[model samples]
Every structure is written in C-alpha cells, then in structure tokens.
Target: MSAMQLDAPQVYDVIVVGGGNAALCAALSAHKAGATVVILEAASREERGGNSRFAGTAFRAPHQGLAHVKTVLCEQALEDAERCSMSPYTPEDYRNDLQSTSHGRNDPLMSEIMIQDAWETIEWMKDKGVRWETTLRKYYNIETQKGIIIDLMSGAPVKVVGDGEGLIRDLYNAVENASIPVRYDCPAHELLTSGDTVYGVRTRQTDKYVDFYGQVLLACGGFSANPAMRRQYLGEGWDLVPVRGTRHNTGTMLRRAVEAGARPVGHWGAAHASPQDIDAPLTGDITKTPVIPRYSYTYGISVNVEGKRFFDEGEAEFGLTYAKIGKMIGDQPRAIAYQIFDQKTIYLLQTRYSSGRPIVADTIRELATKLDVNPTVLERTVQEFNAACPGADIGHFDPHHLDGLCTSSSLAIPKSNWALRLERGPFVAYGVTCGITFTYGGIASDDKARVLNNEGKAMPGLYCAGEIAGGVFYHNYAGGAGLTKGAVFGRIAGREAALRAKGAGGEAARFRPCKMEAAISSRRTA
Candidate 1:
C-alpha cells in the first residue's frame, strides 16, 4: 500500500531544525530573503537557548580596521588559518583543516563555502542590528612578543557582545513578527528524502509522528551530551566526562543526516574544562568560595599523571588546551590535574570563571589530600616552580612573565619582588575535568553552507551551519571565533538554501545509505 499523503501539504520555503544562533540566523535570513521559514525546535521557546547564548560574546579576527577590512578577505583568513592548522595547507586550506581535524571525514565542498563567505556574513550581521563593543583589544601580548597574537587596529573593539538577551530577543521577536510557524517540543527523527535530494523531515511530537515537507537545515547541534555518540566519536573514556553545554544538543538530527548518506566531518571532541564541580550537570550549580573567577586574568598550567607540567600554562584558549588534554586521558592514576591558585588568583578567576564548584584547603598538602593527589609531589611541584620563577623559567617549563608569579604561596613564589608567592594558607583547589562545550568536528560545507555528499557534490535542498559545518580551523581556536563562524555561515546556508528551494524542480533521486559496518569498525580504531 502507498504511504498516506496529506491532501493539503503544509508547505514552506525552508524548515530550520534548531533554535540556536545559527538556526535563528538561518531562519531569519531565509525569511528576509523572501522565503517562508519555519523553525522546529526540540525545546520550548523559553528553553530554546543553546550554547550560543551562554558564550563569551567575543568575535575574533586576525586584522581589524575598517580601512583594511577588505584586505583581510577570504584569502587572508585562509592564510591565517594555514599558519596554525595541523594539516598541510591547501588552496582549500580551511576545508582541509576542517577535514583533517575530523581526521579526513568531513564534507569538503561545504567547508569551502563556509570559509569563503564567512567575512561577508559577519558584515551582514553588522548591517542587521548587531553591534560590537568598541573598546576591546584584538591581540594578546606574550613575553618577547613571539607567540600567538591577534592584531588589533587602533580605536577598534576586539570583542563584541550580542546583548545576550537582546540579540536573541530581537531575532525571536522578528521570527514571531514574520508569523513563521515554530513547532516547539518537536524533535525531528529523520529526513524524508526522494533519492539524492531532501524532501522533508519526520518529527516526533507529543507521542505522535508528524511529517513535514520542505528543505531542512540540520542545526540541532553536536552530540556532546549524547553518551553513546560521545563514546562512538570521542572515546570510550568519554562516558565519565561531563557535558557542559545545553542538553538538547543530543545529535539526534545529525544521526538522521548521516543515515541518509551525509558524511561526518571534523569528529574530534574539543571542549572547555571547568574547575568548579567535577562531572557536574551541564546546567545549574553556581558555587561561592575562594575559587578563581571565570575568564578573569588567569593562565592555565596543566600537569600530567606524573605531576610534571606540560604545555604553556598561560595559554588561555580552552580549545587548544583540550586538544592537548585529549592526548593525556587514561595516562595515569586520577588522570587529572589541579589548577593551582591562591587568594589573588582566586579573585582574578572570580571575574572569568563562570559556572563550576571550587574546593578550598589551607595548605598544599591539604589541597593535595582533598584532591587525592600525592602531597609530596604537589609540594615539590610548587617548590620547583617557585625556585624557577627568579629566572623566569620553571625548570624545563619556561615561564613567560606575562603575568606575575603566584605570590600568596611562599612555597611556590619566586624570590624576585616581581614574582608573587603562593604563600597564604587556605589555598584553593578546584577539580579540573575535561568538559566539552561543543563538538568542533562536523559535516563539511562550502562557503555557501551546502552539505556535500560522499562524492563531494552539493546535495540539493540540503544545507548546514554552526557546529555542523567543518573545516574552519584545524588545531587552535581563538576565543569567539566559533560563534562568529556559526552566525556567519548560518546566514550563508539560509540564503543559499532558499535560492535552491525556489529553483528546485522535479523529484531528485533518493540517497542510498552507506554501509555503516565499516564506519563503525573504523570508529573503534579512531
């Protein structure tokens, strides 16, 4: 028997699958571009806030000047990406980075499009009601001035705030004013495709299945919260790791896409480790203690299982640090490291660290005991660090005196007056666990944000943005770039998807599902 068809199809120009910044931008952009758009959000409108809303509202770029903005075009962005990328840079350097970071598994065409159009999208956002704060600096100065730095132009703001509620509120209000249909508590189960082209989406809502037809945008987010997908993509050990973002980002829609022949790209799970509560729930829990503030003037020095410091402690970018940390998991007992700090350090961190529980102890030994680490090792680590501070070098680990040393702890403070000792008792210790904010790896998309099939051709009526698009960066992520990429690319995808919908004709061939046995087996090795 033929499947029952709706006598009157509830048609739209496009259907957006997520409610985050990317999804919102895409839906709004498509609507403004003269397409009827509908947003199918898995959560209630009130609870629809995704990781974008909770982000540190900063937009990162290499060169900043209204005068030189044209010079810092797509080519310049691609070149800057190549300098820090892990893969051999290509003309499609951004796309290669996206795929290489995902271990050569993302859609290259989509990746290319997103990179190509990112700057224009940012400009469009500015044209629309988004305004960046003008007083921030765009660069970081390390000692000797030989380190990763983002060049900031004179009189230009380095970071921009989304007005948090204001940005989303405006988009939400605009979406409502447009009279776009939004189905809340409706979770898309799978894509209904007619061969190679997507036709619609099957959703599960209120214990009933509803089939909606239109071009679908899979913006449901990455699988950071799904334990099964986390284990499959990240690793088996990820079962113990806590998710630190929205719970609705379960990757359900992504699974459906993959099942329909959409190749996965950029699968590495990069995350932000919170020091407050170990393995805490993604939402809720604010602790009051002598712990360091969130995002304050703080630097990180990570130690391995051997209690030896590895990597530059001052590197503030969490994505870069997590890529390094992902290498050390299961290396030794505890498989953990303590973020060493004192009272002043606590105050500094209090300004930056957002949500996490903190542990307080009066001595290094006491702090070590509370964390179940070796007291002698911890003490020696502190002493050696302190002694090395005089020469601005911590044993083999060189200390670039960008920030002064820990002065409160005498055991760890350098002899130099410039160095601050970690002497004061009641030392604070926060358990640092590898927590993921979002997945960096995803399907590769072009500058236009079109999702390409395994053969590297754009799939008609299919588009993606946000964390779903891969190949923007390879190893390092400057703060605020992810959100910028998402918002920018989402607009690109929305506009292009609307164009495709308007021009589409005839039934496209259905996608044949790939053999997953091999992919699953390969995942085991990954």
Candidate 2:
C-alpha cells in the first residue's frame, strides 16, 4: 500500500496527512467532489487509523427519538428496533451539553457547525457503507412495554457495528472504492508552502524524503503519546501517565502547522484523560485492540493512596466526569486510585469492567490489605462513608439516571448520587490510573475547517480536522462527540480544499489520469 510502489502522480488535488477516521472521510469526500487525492499515514498498514481505531465505537448526535435513529442503523439493529425507546435529542439539548461540559469555553462557531451537521454526517457515513447499532442496553429500563428506554444522561446511544476498528475499516473501504490511494508509513514531516499557502507535504518514506504536491489536509491527531509534549503542555507527572491511543500521534505535524504560522487554540493543560485498568499497557494491546476502560466508578467510592475519599465519585454521570476524574487520579500520589464496591452495587458495573482483576475480600480491612493501602485508614474511611450513606436498601438505587440517593451533606466530600452503604460482605476493589486518550490543544481552524493564521484569517490551501483541530473541547467532554466532530469537519475540510484546488486548476489539474473521471473511465483498481 506504499504510494512509491504505484505509478505515482506528480501531484494531486488533495493530499491528506494521517490515516484515521477524519483523514479517510476527507479523502473520500474530496474524491467524491472530483479531486485526485492521496493519503499519508505515519503508521504501517497494520497499525493505521491512529487513535480512532482504539476509540469506543459510539457517537453522540441529535436525533428525533428512535424513529430518526433507525434511519442510520444497520439491518441487525433494525431487527430489535421495537424493543428500543429514546427521547428525542434536540438541537438545543446537544448545544447545552457541549456548553455545559466545556464550561462555555468551546468555540461557538465550531460547536454550532458540529451540532448542525452531526445527523447529516451520520447519514452520509451510513450511505458510504458504515453500519451502526445502539449500545449499553443495560442503561435502559427493559421491563416496560416499550422494552428498553434509554437514559438521557447516556448521551451516546449509537455505536458503529464493529466499534472503532469497524468504523476505520468501512471508511477505508469507501476511500478505496473511490480510488483514493493511501500510502502507509509515509509520515508527513514538513508542509510545502508558498508564502501563506500550503501546496504539498514532504514525507519520510523508508530511507529517503518524498514530496507529495497537493492541497494539504492535516488530521494527524494530538500529542498524548509524546512524553516531552505531555510534561511540557499538561504539566508535571503527565509524561508518566498511560497513553490510551496510538503512539504515532507525536504532534510532528501539529508543531509543523504552528511553525507555518497557524494559530494554536483551546486548553493546552486539559485533555481527554479517563480511568482504565491499572494493569493496562501503555499503548494498548499488541494487536491494537481497544483498552478496557473502567468507567463504573460512579457506582462506587474512589480513594487515593492515603486511603481517603478524595472527590465525589458520582459528581455527575460517567460521560461528563470521567475525564476530570482521570486527571484527578493522575494528580494523586503515584498517579493511582482504587474504586471500592460492595455486593450491593457490584452488578451495576458496566460490561467494560469484565476484564478487570478486582481484589476481593470479605471485610473492609481485608480489602484494604489486599489493595496495599493502610488497613486502619481504609477501614475508617469505609466506616465514615457507610455512616454517611442514606440506607442499605437497593430498591431506590437506579443505574439509569441521577436518583438523588446521596451521602450525608456533613461528609467532607458528599456523594451527589447513587450512594449505597458499603456494609455488604465480599467487597471488591479495582485499581485505576489516568489513561490519556487525546490532548485538547492543537492548530486552530475555522467553522469551514480551513486552517487559520495567528491573525484569524483562513490560510489558503490548508485545512485540518479530527483531534488536530482543537477548540471544540476544553476541560471536559461528552462521550461520542469526537467521532461526530471528526466526520463533520473532515467532510467540510475535504469539500472546501477540493473546491479550492479545482478552482486553482493548473498543469496538475490537466494531468487527468489521477482524476475521478479518468479512474472511472479506465479499469478500476479499487
């Protein structure tokens, strides 16, 4: 799949850097808009798709209940359609969630574009052969005639059929079907620019430098995997945290974009970090399997190394507070924390924790000793927490919504919701730490997905999408928004760049063999 092996073109209309979802979407869209496109992926073919491959397969979108959701669903999902029920996620609901999570710090224009285009983009991807399914059936109450009624707080109801890997596979198939060539292991190192306009990219191919001339789209992702950048941008001890995504997203292209005069935007100190297994590897599975995240902390109490409850584990739903909790744990001693659960709330844990190795004990003291924390402090902490709980009754404990079952207000850090007394025997504990998914800081871009200079003007011939285009998120994030944001902006960048390249037609445009019409006219290789 190397570009050098093929009869390479002298130049293309669009050259997309990165092989993730955004880059694939851009390439597919640009090819549809009648442009010759090529993709430059930093990873080899086997390890391609960047962080998007490791991402959870869900997407948060504005839908008019299950009727609208069925429009983008696969045939398999449609079979069980009658058993599902979802309240309509209106445009206002989407807007408010974004604002509330980012604390109103998200770029208004970018947020607006995402909200407006989210559903349409999902439909577009579905038309391009992507299949979707509603996940987390347990979050819905399945006893009623309506079958499973979704929880409003669980914003992301739909996920791609095969998760992240399935998403990238479908998109890559679309790209190949459209005759767009993707060159793996060809990492773009420098932007080939003419003054303020980017014209191409210089990539490192094997042992030599190869230049691919075209309208450039940068979607190479954030620098969470880079230790120097993490420590420098995210502050102390960040470099030691586990990476939840690809190790190839080292910010080479992001730094290059900034060096080429693109303005940096968003919260540099914040990121999409979240809690995962303490034993999880730094770069996920060797086969690039998605890491099993432990987001069931909302049903339990999390304690620091000192055996004291540090923060409210149920301050909000897991979607809104997981990133904040991850950062909080990362700031704790040794960047470690343990989530304690009892028999009462153990069944409420999500299936994502099925692979976790929880330390089990019949008593609080035994559990503390197994966790390596001071038994006296841990026992006291559990006792104090138990005294604060309302009662041991599990009837009022609803896992779907914020049932106001909270700990006593007099406690130093009161549990806001789902507070159950940990008095049951056979207690369980799962050790956790921060897993950095992606950074929130990168080169700036406009609503149209055009790269912006320091003066806020759109730079000609340059565009960005995916995690590389920041400002949509800040301190917190809603689950599934990343995939939507990428698709919406990737399509936008692809179309805008293609139009510009078509309008700026020169000798490259006259070279018709690489064009869409020529590929269709000849024996198609895709």
Candidate 3:
C-alpha cells in the first residue's frame, strides 16, 4: 500500500528504507518505541516483501525446547512443533557457528551480538504479531529407505511460524495496524546528509524526486541482483548465475551508502547462493523459493553436463558449508549439474520444495539421456560408486548425526558421506544451477546497528541492518541465519535510531568523526 498523505511533517522519527524482513522489523520496532516510522520500498505492493517472501519460513533463532516453540508458534503449528524433537541452541553454539562458517573472518562483535540477541529478536517478533514454527528436517537412514524415521536437522532447526510470507504478512499487519506509512514503488536514491549526519533521503517517486527527511534506517539488502556489481565483485560467470531473491535488490541502497562514506566490510567476492532448478525463473519463484534448491544432494550425487561427477556432494555441511555448494555448481560446465537419486534413496527426498518439474526414468542410462548426460559415463560412474559403497565405513548409515559412510577416496571426486549405490530402478535427476541469495559485502555497522563512517566512528542519525549491513557472513553461511540476522539487527537499528532521533545521545556524542584509513585500521585492530 502507498503511504497515506497525512499532514506533511518536517521529518519522521525513523525512515526505514527498503521492505523485507529486516525493514519491516525495523519499522515495527521503531513504531513500538513511540516513533513516527515510514518504510520506503522500491518494488510494487505485490512484490514488497523482497527476498524474504521467497525463502523458506525457517529461522535460526535460539530456543530452549519444544515448550518454547509451542509458546512462540501459532496454534495451528503448535501441535506439529510440540510433537517435533529439537535441541536447544545455546549462544555459544551460534557464536561457534559464525566462527566456523566464516573461518573466523567475521566481525567478532557483530557475531556476538547476533548470538546474544537472536532469542530476544524472535521473542520481539512474536510480540510484534509474528508467529514461529519448528524448522523440522528429515534425513533418512539408508536401511530405513521405506521411511520409518527421518532425523530432524543435525542441529537446532527453528522455523518461523510461517515461512517467509507469513513472516512478512504478520509484520505487515503490525505495520498497517500501527498506521506506519509504507511508500511502495518509491526507491531512495541517496541519503539526505548534513555534515556527518544523515537527516533524510532523496527518493525517486512515481514521476519526480521527493526529499524525505528523517533519521534513516537502511535495510535495503545487498547487491546480489546488480549485474554489474556481481560481475565486478564476484567476477566472470557471476552475472549468469540467477538470483534466488528479488530483482529489486540492485545494490542501490548499498552503493548510495558507500558513496556517503560508509566503509564496506565482509567478503566482496562471496555471497550466499544455492543450487536451484536449471529452468526456474530468473528471479525466485514467489510460489517456491525455499524449496527450490537441490539441497538433498547429500542424499545422492551430482554429475555435471559431461556426465562426470563434480565436487563431493556429501560435503553439504549440515550447518555451515551449504553456501559453497552453490558456487561449486556455478563453476561447473555450463553452470549446470544433475542431482541423481536412485530408488534406494528416493524416500529420502524432500521433494515438496522442489522448484522445477522433475525428470524421471526407470534406469540410470535412461535418466542420463533425459538429463542429457553421457549414458556410458553415467553407467561407469554408478558402477564404480557401487563397488566402493559396500566397503564404506558408514556405521549404520545414521541420519541423525554425521554418518561417516564415505565413498572410496581413490575416485577423482568421492562422495564423502551417504554413498548409496544407484542400483535400484526408477531413478530421478533434477537439473540445477546456482542462484545468488545475498551478497557478503555491505556497509560496516556496529553491534547496535549504527552505520559506521569510513573513519570507523558511528555516522550520526544513520543506522543499517539486514543484508545491507555486513560483517558476520563471509563465503559460507548457516541455513536459517539470514532471517535471524535481519530481524535481530533490524530491531537493534530501529531502536537505536529511534533513541538517537529522540535526542538520547546529545550533541557531543552525536557528531564524532575520524580519519578514513585510520578509522578502518582501528576497527580492524579492535
């Protein structure tokens, strides 16, 4: 919906730019804290949720047990969540996850903030009219292929009460109920700055540019959808990779912030990507984004267009290493891979989220033909994999924990785990390619989500959160953490910006500045 033309005030308390999980979270949080908040979204109302609408309803929030889930989720999901098995995700676990996932390159302060405040953010969302559900996982043991027990995800799996849409819906409801004006189809082209302070924004409206004055909170997301930025930062073949989220995330907000002197942080060349259907739409399909990725590749094996296996599919690090798998596929021949699963592992497929139509055949050779892979090479690959499978040291083929059932290392690319032979008939293959989720590089912000100037000091009246604010993620990422990061930091930025706009920090603390490289160097050393 378009922003209502209430009496034109000189400025709002908080002007949250962008519309998504993070932006909505910020707007609602600011409104709750007794501030006039306005949300500026680039897309039309129909496409306003941004990438979040295309994602699975999963969240990586901290929780104690099933009881905590029951309290947070809606009544409809309570029963399923209560019946589901879950483990408590301690703050330390979240910290370790960030460290291990980013190989310790993530900002320690920001990582700690996410781990420390994730639970609070989820609870805050619940208070803001949001609901949650258990992000239940299902991995079957090779012995129980008929589907007896499927392990929940290896670690804690927290699903939003509803997937992405539900999240945005609830948040939108809150915004609407609060009468927070959200100007759809209006994109903020640049920040309205006064010395070191950001007082408002220069927005491009229907047919003209309008100046929106306010203490700005940026939740505009990263530059993944920007073709030129992708080619420039991520290098060749990057622009060809389909975007798994919104086309509106053209890095406009990010580039604007950088031009305004915000220091960029995190991996410029890296992003959170995944293996999506080869024929899926250029951007994420609103109907099936969360389920589009060929994540179940760990249960099978993937072959490139040449009918030759690529990387070890089993390296699908249940928690952290999932991001690498996408780029791996992007780097392959024609940026395509075929995930093959035989009858033995057919029951293990989570095909409910499958993005594109599936190609099925009774035999491996037939499946190869349909997938356009060399049938002879496919046959040899399966045969060789089968020979080494029976001798694998895969104790019990347990799906709960890490089952070390590995293929022969002598092969060019071995399936590190879940090495089941494609001996059964009725095989299936899903052609897949990489789709970029969010970019890794973004404006540097503090734990409180205050935007940092190039000189390392906080930029007055400017705050950032969501994918637009970077630091924690690098090349790798955990599955549901994106939403959590957005919510947690969004809430923080909203609250902090609201307080600052309310004159809580005073003039002396408001206008601090430092030298450029020195500020970055000091932040680095800290």
Candidate 4:
C-alpha cells in the first residue's frame, strides 16, 4: 500500500473548509485561540463567500433596546439611529421564536446554545471589525408615519453596513490581518482519518491530489446550489428553482462528511426559501444590492397562472413570512406567480422592487393578458378580494405593524391583515418565483459544534458549523437568524477545534501510513 503524499511540510493545527461568513468566523476564532489554522476555499477569490455573500446581513440577537443594539452599530448607523425605532428583543423572545418557527422540532440543546450566545457572538464579530447598522429599508417600508420604526418584536432591526458582501469583506480582512493562509480553488474531497479520528483533509489542486493533516472543521454551506441533491432530498421540482446564493456550495464536503459516518439531521425535505424576481439569475449575483428578493408581497396580493389568489398575502409580517413564501410560490402552477399592487401601495414595495420590471395596465383585463392569465378570472379575483375587505381607511394601514384590517373570514382565502382594497389604478404587478437560499438538512453536530456519528457519539477531531451544521433550524427560520446561528456555532466550533488541537500537541511532524489511509490512497491512485 502507498501512503498519500502530504501537501506541505508544515502541518496546520486546524484546517477550515469554506470561505464565507461561517468559515471565516471559525478561522478567525481558531486563530485567536492560538491555533495554526488554514482555510480551504472551493471558490476562487472572485467567487468566494458562499451563500453569506448574497444574503441580507440582518442579525437577530437579543437586545435591551436601541441603546443595547447600538453597542455593535457602526459610526454611521449610530448617527442615523435616532431616526429609527427598535423594540427590544429579549432572550425569551429569541427562544420562543426559534421554537415556534421550527414547529417545535428544532434540536433543543443546539437551539439553546444559539439563543444564549447570539448577542455575545455579535459583539465578538464587532470586535473583529464587523460594522452594523439599523436598516428597516430591507424588510420594512420607510414611509411609516412614525419616522422609521424597526419593531424587533418579530423582526431583525440591524444589518451589516454593505449587507452580506460587506460582511464578507470585513471578515476576510480580519482573516488576512491574522495572517491565516486561505487556499482558494482547493476543494476538499474527503476526510483523512486514522482509526475513527479525522486528522486531515484530502484535496486535489489541479491534477494531483494533496493532503493537509489537521483537525478538520467543515463550515462549508449546504446543498442549495446542487440540483441533483435538491431533487433527491428536497423533492422533484426543487431542481428547477433558482439559487439565492453562491454556486460553489454544491454539498461536496457535506456528502463526504455523511459518507464518513457523520449523522445527517434537520429538515432534509425543507429549506430557507424566499420570493425572487422572475428574471433573476439561476445563481444570485453577490455584487448586486438587495439581490432579487421581492418581499413586499405582504402589502399586496399574489395570483397563480390561472389568475387566482392562492395563499393569504397578508398572512403575517413580511419578516416572519418571507422565508416560506418561496416554497409556496414554487408549489404554484409552472412554479410562477404575480404580485399585484395598486398605486395606493405601489410605493410601499421594498427597494428590491427596482430590480423587477412591473407589468402595468389601466385595467385588470389588460394586466391579466400581460401575465398570461384569464382576464375574467383575474378581474373576479380582485373583485372578490376587494369585496371581502372591511373598507377601512388606507391612512390607518401601518406597514410596520400588523394592522387589524383583514378581509372577511367568509372568503376561501382571507387576507389576514393589512387588507386594503386594491381599487385605485393604474395597477402594477411583478413576476415572481421561488428562490432557495440554503438547504436545512446537513451533518448533525453537538452543542460544541462537534460532528456526531450515526450512533450519536461525537466524531473525534471533526467539527461542523454554519449551514452545514444541521438541526439548528427545521422547516422555517426567522429572518436574520441564519447569519446569527452561523456566527454563534462557528465561534464555538472554532474555539473547540483549536483547544482540541492544542491538547493533541498540534499536527504530527511526520506522516505514517495507516492501513485504512494506505488502502484508500492506493485506490485513488489507480
């Protein structure tokens, strides 16, 4: 049996796989803990950051009030803070939201850790050079009568300065400042193990294979961008849905970990999905601000191809309901829908509406023609929706809160709240479809972010975090919770991996071929 060649003479204490917010957080934390760490990024420099780069940078953390959250805000955000109102987000609020959103199926221990450590992790990231701001523009309309109110009672009031891309830039800068080596275009294929303990990663650079021996931490993203995995796990039509993040997160590392005996958990059949502009790219562009989200559907009504209202457009606040709207839209006919709004609420749409071309018509018949729906059905649907409304004054319609003006319960699908009549013209509609952000199912890990085996035992020398660390969320997740969970567990995984590496006295100075490794290497070479 031939032994696999080591990549370099210097063995890193920790080998982090991925380059996005989670991976960077882990790498930074491990390095700060006095471990020699190296990051293996699948994407090149230009295409790094995983799903995090294209995400909205809102972070849902427990805070006292505006004063408490301002501790992590940047200079500019502080200057603009007085203009915005932020309701306090308590620990109980955070805990209940997580439990309720996951339908009480979330991992209890992991959820507790995230809930407790969320705020602290945000502060830690702030210390590491993350700039935050209280921006309601992404998820809320700014034209509210009470200036700009950010009601965190069920929303995320804060966001990164330049959004997700800005977050990646800051974290990358921190990684660089720490002098950690990040090997781009080097995607890890498998874990190198001796006995049941993973000690290194096997990656191919160009044509030849090379190995980096260390404590492996998989912060790589989920399988949203992998069409085959989507079909296999998330069901049939998921393969045709557009991705809202990086194309590099194809679940290679995740599959490798599972094949290596790590346990898979969470909602494999579910994901964090949202509505996107119909013409958006298959993989979202990170450089674009606001990306392709059309979350303002809460202020209007959506119809399927047959020109019929499907779900309650005003079911809940946009932040709480936006994530699941994509899945609902995907289940529609041809996986397409149109959000119709009148001049009364057209200006209430989020800024992301600028990315879409609105189909405008003086009448519902012409609009139905443009959307390729039945003209008569479209007109009737609108009339029924309008008739069901209580005819409340539009002036009392508060976009910041759930205004009690709902449609009559007698209708088949009543608009739950903020149900204003769509009477004024010219009416406008934006085409929409499902856009998947990340897969919820992934390798299961313990509270410390240590990977667990099928038997529910911790896998030695192996850790997982970020989207790859499953069970933190199930069917649905709160907005801004993704980044917060990633940061919290990523910090834990990094620190724990580093401490373990220190206990092991770092990586071995020389390579010795174990029977298992030798056999695997020989097969690969053949």
Q: Which window of 10 residues has the lowest lDDT sum in candidate 1?
A: 284-293
Please list all clashing residue pairs in model 3, or write none if there are none.
57-163, 132-161, 133-160, 133-161, 135-159
For every model shown, the clashing-pair count is 52, 0, 5, 0
Winning candidate number (TM-score): 4
In order, the Cα lDDT scores of the candidates are 0.56, 0.83, 0.77, 0.84
**Candidates in order: C-alpha RMSD to true structure:** 9.7, 6.0, 6.7, 2.4
TM-score, structure 1 vs. true: 0.71
Q: Which tens-of-lDDT digit does each residue in 283-305 have in candidate 3?
A: 76676666676677877778888
lDDT for each residue of candidate 2 in 1-526, tens digit (9 for 90 to 100): 3322222435888999999888888888898999889999999998898988888867888888877788788988886566656678888988998999999999999999999998889889999999987764433323332444444443676888777789889988888888788899888888866567777777876555666777899988989889999999999999988888888999999999999999999988889999888887887564433646888888889998889998888787787788777899998998899999988778777765667897999999988888889999998998899899898787888776788899997699999999989888799999998899999998899877999999999888899999999998999998888888988999999998899888989744543334423433342343
TM-score of each: 0.71, 0.92, 0.89, 0.95
Candidate 4 residue 452 C-alpha distance from true site, Å: 0.5
lDDT of 4 by residue, 421-460 (tens): 8888899999999999998998889888999999999988
Local error of candidate 3 at residue 394 (angstroms) = 8.1
Best by lDDT: 4
Clashing pairs in 4: none
